[model samples]
Target: MTTALFPPAPVSTWLVPLDDTADGVVASLGLARPEGAPASWLDADERARAARLHDATDRHRWLVSHVALRLLLGAALEVHPSAVSVVREACPRCGGPHGRPALGPSAGRPLRFSLSRSGGHALIALRRGLDVGVDLETATAGTPSPAAPATDGLARWVRTEALLKSTGEGLTRDPDAVALRPTAPGVWSEHVEGDDAAGPELVGPAPTVADLALPSPLVAAVAGPGLDRARVRVHLPATAAA
Candidate 1:
């Protein structure tokens, strides 16, 4: 994509492979922790939440996602990983604390991002000012979880999820109502309101949506205003320590 045809901000996309061994995850992430305690990279609330997850794999995945997020933001801000502050705004619909996550003032600018993980892979997307959402999933042979839409429905499903997540409504909105039509390579036209519903459902403004060119077994998508124009740089071999 040329810069003239579509003016875009610099965006970075990172993929991280989840470690199968839970014990070495902290060290692999280059994070420190007190003896017999959770990783120091996580805040008190995060630690408490992690402690609540009885499943080791689930806990490890959560730790890796948040830790990776902190490291990524810190690298961009040139600060200690733990120093990067993040918060979850209250839901616009119900005034709850489960809304989309946001960076603190320390992040500077309108740094927006979205994080998603499926099976063994984790994805983090970053964009400035423009809101962005990303989803990563694997369609390998296995029982599909309720959280994951079926593999047969990935194209539409992933794009819809990316759009909903971009607006912070998430799965709260009926998935059947969201739809998109491909306009070109890496470009999709979003129908915020579609034939699935009869009312005037507000989905905010549409964003530039596209399917990511990822390796096999993994399907992903990104959505944001002008994102189709944004330069997307994908870094692979997600096993790096940084």
Candidate 2:
């Protein structure tokens, strides 16, 4: 059967393989550090943040992931690395509320972006004038614990959370207020409303969610306006060894 060709749109997505070193990622994006900016990853509160992450690997991964996101966004915007800023903020635990991450001087522009990382893969979505959110889940083998929630329930919860995050609404409200529906295996979407007092109401069809056919189990979902027609491209970093 012939597959239908997707018409191109302004929305662009890039999936970088985990093998890409932090430096390689920056170089690949053709981004350079702005003059007089500090070369290290640590911000003003690095010491406090380091104390919070007990696992060394987790800490490393977090740092690497943030760096990769900045590099990817920089490349897309053709801006210097130092000109992009990422802030770690909290989200609502129950509903579609997300916190705003710090942005550089260019924040006023119409650029919108989302980032997701799981296992050995990282995904980035970029679009203009649309609220965007992306999520990645690594599949695991074996049965879930009896106390663990059902797959459908988990998917719903995740979808709601992702939508909240996409709109810069973090866990500032009750998570139970949002409702989610699973459209397919490893794919889910939610309709959220009454969450953003000043933002547009999130209504209409959610973006298409799909699982990448990789060796490891991975589930990914994207949500945004006009996502149904937006063209998506996944990029695997060249540094990854096949």
Model 2 residue runs over 4 Å out of place are 1-8, 17-20, 26-52, 87-98, 105-108, 143-148, 151-158, 173-177, 181-215, 239-242
Per residue, candidate 1 scores C-alpha lDDT tens digits across 58-96 of 888888787777666665555676777888977867889
Minimal lDDT window, size 10, model 2? 1-10
Best by TM-score: 1
lDDT of 2 by residue, 1-242 (tens): 00111123555555655555666655444445433433354344543564588887666565666666655555555555556655544443433323555444545566677777775667776666676776665655564413225544544444555566576664554457655555555544554455662333446544434333333455555666545532554444434345
Query: Model 1 TM-score?
Result: 0.80
Off by over 4 Å in 1: 1-9, 20-38, 142-145, 192-205, 238-242
Candidate 1, 73: how far from true, in Å?
0.4
- Angstrom error of the Cα, residue 141, model 1: value is 3.7
lDDT of 2 at 83: 60
